[model samples]
Every structure is written in C-alpha cells, then in structure tokens.
Target: MFGDAADAMGGMGSQEDSLVQIGVLVPLSPPGWAEAGRQLLGGLELGVREVNAAGGIELQLLVRDTAADPRKAEAAVSELAQLGVAAVVGEYHSVAARAAAARADALGLPFLCSSAVLDALTEEPTDLVARIAPAQSHSWRIYADFLLAAGHHRIAVAAQTSVYWAAGTSILRDHLAARGGTVIELNDLTPAALCDELADSRATALLLLTGTPEPAVAIVRSVRRDARLAEVLIGAPAGQPELPAWAALLGQDGAGIPFLRYLPEVFSPLGARVDAALRETMSAEPSFVAFEGYDTITALAEYLRVGSWAAVSVEGTRGQIRFTRTPGVGVWQWAWPPAQVADRDPAAPDRFRVLHTA
Candidate 1:
C-alpha cells in the first residue's frame, strides 16, 4: 500500500508541473479612448481562453490593466515582471508602449505591442520589443499613394496639432513629392479654420490626418455647404471609424469622396472567421486595436510552445512578424492597399474592396 501511494503522489506531481504560465498586460481603461482598449483586452482574453480550451497551452496567462497612462504602464510592467511572466503584451498607445518597453527591457521580459504606431516605440529595439502593427510611416505612404493614384495632383494636407500628425506629415510630404503630386498646403487646421481652408483650396484633394473624427466631419459638412468644393476629394486617416457621419451629413457627395484605409477587407470573410471565433469565445468584436493584442499573445504562445528562441520570424493574420538585426525597427509587413485600387469605390465606402500587392 505504501508503494502504491508513492506512485500515485508522483503522478499527481508530474501532472501539476506540466502547465506553463504567461503574462498578458493590457490597459483596463485607456485614457481618452476606452472602447478601443476594451476591445483589445477582450480579444487577448478570448485568445488566451481559446488556446487553453484546445488541449490547453503549456503557459497560463496573467493579465493586468495599465490604464493607458505612461506612468501606469511602467508600474504594470514592473508588476508583471515581479509576477515572473515570461513575456508581456500590451498598452495600445505608442507612448505607453515605449514606457512599458523600457521597463520590460530592464527586467529582461519580452514585450509585444498591438496598436502603438509611433516609430519611436521601437527606437531602441531591444529583443524585448516586438510589434504586430506596422509603423506609422507605412500608413502615411499608403495614404499618399492612394491620393496620387486617384489623379489628385495638387493636394492639401491638414491635420490637428499633434505628434501623430507631425510624424505623418514628413512621410506624406516625401511620398507626395516622389509620386509627382505637389503638396500645395500643409497646415494645422482647427475645426472652423479647416472648413474655411477647404472652401478656399480649390485643390484636387484634401488629405486629413487628424486623430479626432470631429474635424473630418467638419470638412465634409463644409464641403457640402459649398458647391465649389463638392467635386474636391476628401480623405482622412483610416484609424478613425467615424466616416459614417461624413456620409450621413453629405449624402451622395460624401460617397464621391475617398477615405484612405489599410486592410479594407478587415471585415471580409477571412477576417470575419478570425473575428467570429474570437467573438464567440470572448463576446466582443475585433478591431485594429485588438488585433495587435491577439497577434502578440498568439506569437508569444507559439514561441513558447515551439521552443524557437532563435527563430526571429512569425506570421500574423495582418502581416509578417519578425525582428530585424537593427536594434530598433523590427521587421514587419506593411499590408497597404495597392495604388491601383485607392479610389476603386469612392461612391460606396462600405462596399469598397482592397487590392493586395502580388
């Protein structure tokens, strides 16, 4: 009886030792942007649960919210590190990502990011920092190409006074010039001033890179109010999902204007399958914000499962995820809409399709 008891105890100990634990750090309440952050956290949780349900992952997940503050981000990282997480995933803001990356680097924990677009996040690219989202520069290039291909030669680039716009302006300017489209006006415009400028530009197109949706709506309303600006194409950053207002406000005229977008088929069949699986498990829809979270956690889990520490590359639903030899600027695929299809369906924004490069 004593020998049988000993064997049973040994088996129980082995079973308990098989499980592995991983850390998932996210913003519980993203300051100024709660919805997007909530979706991100939801996706991460669903991904974790899904992985566990399928024969269970070797790693268990530890989750915490960063509150979207840089200081809080640092604290979250520290907390996760103290918990002895093998990897940390989180904080959608680029600034917050950078702060957490610094902390993760210090603690020797791998940090994966979902929504941070600023180029500065990976500036010091330690092995710890990897991103599922393409850099901001890539978005600018796609937007510029979209304008040029739409036969928009003389363009006006307007944006709010923010760092996001500042970085985008330089890249947009370069790409516009390269494509032989002159950026005739590059100014910071408030809601009221923006309306006045659009009314006056008489330019072929207006490219807006503002973070807030208010100004884009204002531009559309101003254009509708004036017939001269009616034919002028209006474009805004793809990140903001408030384009429905422009359509509702301007009706048919808004349909004629283009909104630059990346991953235009984000809700298509392929995307829908992934989204549906996540939703069914987590009870939420997926967004660009959540995509990074899902991909990062998936990547790290795969890395842990495969024991491929030297393998610097992985494939994500959005694009390639890999580390570059460069200390900063990890290698990633920027899946932009092909230039030929930039204005493919300006009249039907919802029906627009993306053409990927071969």
Candidate 2:
C-alpha cells in the first residue's frame, strides 16, 4: 500500500517535533526505482505506526528523493546531514546506496541500506554503514544451491549488460561449475537472442540474470513462445520474485519460472503482520523491498530506544534481524537476510509460491 492510510499521518512529510529524526532516502520519482520505493514507503509507514502505537519514543523523518542516481544519492546524504538527522534508511539501488554510504560515512551518520546488495558495500568496517539486504554474491550461492537441488545440471546464462549482473553471473558460473554443473552458453540478455541461445545450447535450464522487470518479462515471454525453450527450466538468479510488477507483467509466461528473492513471510509472525498491513494500506502485494524497509525502520527505532545498535536486533520480518561487522564495506553492522526461491503456479499464474527457502 502507498499513502492512502499513512498520508493521514503525514508519514513522508515534514513533522514539527523535537523527537529523533531519521533521514529516509529513496527513489520516489523518475529514474529511481519508484515502484519499489513506494512499496518500501508503505512498509516504513507501517513500522512507524506500529512503533508509535506501542508508545515508543517520538521519531520524525526527513525524507529525500535519490532518483537512483549515485550523484543525487550522495547529495541527499549531505542534505539529510544538514537537516540534522540521527541516521538514514531506504535505498533499493546498489549504486545509489554505495554513493550514499560513502557520504554517510563522511557525515558520521548511521545508514541502513534497505535493499541494495552489491558485495563491496561491506568490504570495510565503518561505524556509519550497515545493510539489511545481503550482497548479490550471497544470493548467488543460494540460487546456485537451489538450481542444483532442483536437478538442473546443464545451464545457460542470459544476462543484462551491467556490472551488477555480470558480477552475479560470474559467481553463479563458478559455483555451478564447482558443483559439476556445466554452463552451456553465456550471452547478453535480449528476448530474441535468449530464445535463439536456449534453442542452440544443449542446456536443460536457462538462467536469466537481469535487474529490471521489463526485460525479465520479455525474456519469459520469449521462452514461453519458443517451442525449443518450452521445456527448459527458467531461473532468474536475482530478485525478480521480489519485484512488485513482475507477475503482472509476466502473466501466464511466469508459470514455473523460479526466481530468487528475500522472503519475509516464511514462518514469521511479525512478517505476516507487516505484509497484511501493507496489503491493506497499499492495495498491493508486499515485495521483499517492503519487508526490508519495514525492518530497517524497526531496527533504527530500536537503536534510538536502546541507545545501541548492538543491543537492538528485532525479529525482523525478513529474517532474524541482527547486525555483525564484516570485512567488506567497512560498515560496523551488516544484516544477512534469508533468501528464497519462488515461482508462479501454472494452475494459478497470479499466485506466487515458495519453492525453497535458503
């Protein structure tokens, strides 16, 4: 859900209060991951309402639009710092998060990345940086394991031409090869090209590594339309299942195609509550970004309440929420959210079901 419910509380607007201020940096408009940002805002607003309803300390938010641009994200950090925020949260793009993290580090502000998953974000230990989403590399291993367990041995990869996609594909290729899986072909992602590649290769499975929803939908449509690829198992190694628009765009072509994502509702009561709240408020299914955004706010509120990020791990909707310092990204805290492999049922293409939780 979006602002229908939270707009009444002025959740994303300026609040006149002496309470603690947290900067919310998200792509709220064009060039930003707007849909994902909207979902995140829904969860964030829900977290705010829950915290306040429970008589937590008063918290005000200083919201900024990053537009998924690194330069703009960096500037937003500076502006938030100028606004005297205690910490910052929200950002779904890895590139934007990286830029914002650097600026946050320089500004001495604690930053919780809600969904960005570039591996280098945690390579160095700094007190200012932490992430609620695991690095892309971490998810790849989980996806690799899922593919192998699903009996996929001969795999072909069709990836979008981006550094992020390239990094993940490389890891997938290596991990699969180590497990005796063969990568029959690798090529740039395109609907027609992928269809031809799948037909030409002896692969039993095709891995589509892409970040955006349009291309992913196109690739899935291509596979469904091509007789040669009709029987091939399709795997989206990134967070396609987490995209709010994926199923709607994919339609019946989404049936049986497995995609990796962070699932907050797998046996978590808190996750269920958050999901239900968002659905009611936004009139849409909650995505992984929403779960992470909610958790980031919950975690930050806890930090403000207890005066220590160390003692504030909540049973996050995404997973057991705890922070540990890792060598990468120099952030003092990092959260490794649990991953899942999910798919749309052939009988009910609109319904997404979890195939495996990693």
Candidate 3:
C-alpha cells in the first residue's frame, strides 16, 4: 500500500512520500524514459510507506522532475538543500544523476543514486555521493561476455552523441577487444544509412547504443526491414528493451534483442514480498529499477543510523545489500546485484526470457 504521499505535481511542493522530507530527483516528463522514472517513483513510494509503518525514523520524499535535464537536476538539488532535505535520492538517467551528484556534493548534501549506472558518476570520489546500480563497466563487461558466448565476434554499436553512450561503447570495445572480438561504432548515421553501414561492416550483431524511440526505434525498424541484416542480432546493453515502451514501439522487431538487467535467478524472501507489493501497484511486472528504488530508501534508513555508506548492511529486495568501494568506482557502491542478459520472447512479446547471467 502506498503511504501518505506529497509530490510537487500534487501541489505538495516536491514530495511523493512524507516523513522526514527526502528529495527525490527523477525524470517524469518527455525526452526521458518516463516509464522507468514512474516505476522508480512507485518503488520509492512503497518503501517509504513500509518504513514508516515499521515505526522507524519517519522519512518524507520531495520529488522533483528532472525531465532528463542536467540543469533541472542541478537546480533541484539546490532547492532541496534549501528546503533542508536530509538527503537526495533517485534519478533514472545517468547524465542527470551525475549532474545531481555534483551539485549535491558542492552543497555537502548526501545523495544516493538509485538507478543510473555511469561508472564515473563524480569527477572525484566524495563521501557524500553513493550509488545502488551496478556500474556500466561491470554490467557491460558481462554483456560483452554474453556477446562472445553467442559467437558474435564482430559487433557494431549504432550510437548517438552522449557521455553515457560513449562510456558504454568504451566498455564494450575494451571488454570485447580483450576477448578477440571487434566492435565497430556507427555514429551520426541516419537509420537507413546505419543499416547500410551495419550490413557493410559484416558485424553479426548490432547493438542499439542510442536513446529511446527517436533514433533507437527508427534504427531497429530500418535494420529489421533490411534483409541483408536479417541474420544480425540486435542488442541493447543499456536496457531499452526491458521497458514496455520498446515493445509498444517495435513489437516483434523488439524481441530477441538481449539487454542487461539486474535480477537474481531466484528471489530472496524479501524480494518476493516486495515483488508482490510492486505488482499490486503496477499493471505489469516491475523491473529491477523499481527494486533499486525500494532498496535506496531501505539502505538510507540504515545509513542514517550508521552514518557510513560502507557500514550499510540491510536486507534489500534484491538480496543482502552491502556497500563497498569497487575498483574505478568513485562512490560507495553496492558491489552488484545479480546481473543477467534477458530479452523479450519472440513467441510472446510481453514475456521476457533470461538468456545469460553473470
């Protein structure tokens, strides 16, 4: 059950859950993955409700819509700080989360990133910022391993200009290179032109390393229509296909495109309970992003008591949550939750199949 919620959109001036007033930054509008943001928000709301019901230190959420804009995220952080939020949490976009983390650090506000996976979230390591999502490098390397196992030695990434995309490309390139696989970056090409380049490259797999629906959906449509690329496998390591929007946009064409998702092969007891709770709030089964949201608050409640990210040891919906300093990661990180490569089933587009795990 959702608790007493006070959100900015609800005229409560930036809050979805109310107790101790925590600022929640998320993309609830266009140009961002609104579906993902909503799921994250839903999970956060549920977590806040349960925590208060348990008679712990009450927590309140001040929700701010980043709309996938870094500037908005920066300003929101400032506003939340002025409002005396204990800490800020939540963000679906990596770029926006990075901007929020920077601003949060500048103001000495604690920020626990929920779902963004950018490796270098901060310019320099600071105690103020911590993350729950597995870094892009960790997840992408596992994805690279999946590619190699599937016999895709030659891979091509159809990407646009973005730091997140660039970082993903680097992870794929570096991981694949070490395993004798070659990656081709197809940038600045029209969907039609991209198909030509993809077919010409002779890469057995084409990864959609671009943004949602605009060019990503268009590229998938073009590639699926091209008979020359029929045999080429399409993958989205950044998890575009995990959401319902991808299926609504591409249907059958969206299936078979493997993407990385953090989920266990078997759910823990807490995971099962949370999953059931989430299913009640959602029309479809919730994704790991939601679990990340729920866990963020659960962890923060414990962190508030311990006063250290590394000391945070709580039972999260995903598994036992513990923070550690991962190599090359600038913030306290939940070393990883279970990660797997999954795709929609071609027979039933609504169903997802776990293809590979790491």
**Candidate 2 local lDDT, 106-155, one digit each (tens):** 76677888888877764356655777888777777888888899888888
lDDT of 2 at 324: 78
Order of candidate numbers by lDDT, starting with the best: 3, 2, 1
Better of 1 and 3 by lDDT: 3
Q: Give lDDT tens digits, candidate 3, residues 1-358.
A: 1111222112232333434778999899989888889989988999988988877357888999999999999999999988977789999999999999999888878899999999999999988789989999999999999999989999999888999999999989999999999999999899888888888898999998888877889998999999999899999998989988889989999999999998898898899999999999887679888988999999987776666787889999878889898889999899888999999999999999999987
Q: Tell me model 1's lDDT, rounded to 2 decimals.
A: 0.59
TM-score of each: 0.75, 0.87, 0.94
| Candidate with maximal lDDT | 3
Which should have the higher lDDT, number 1 or number 2? 2
Question: Cα lDDT of all candidates, in order?
Answer: 0.59, 0.74, 0.88
TM-score of 2: 0.87
What residue runs in model 2 are displaced by over 4 Å at the alpha carbon? 1-18, 264-266, 327-329, 332-335
Q: After superposition, how far is residue 58 of candidate 2 from its true place, in Å?
A: 1.8
Report the C-alpha lDDT of model 1 over 1-358, residue by residue, as the tens digit.
Answer: 1122113122332353345555665655635355556767776766676566665344566776666577888888787767656667766666677788777777766676767667777445455566666667766576677667667878887766656677777777787777777775646666567657766766778776654335666666665676667677776654454223334454554554444433434444534666777666654445555555666666766655443333535555555555444322552322322222233245565444453221
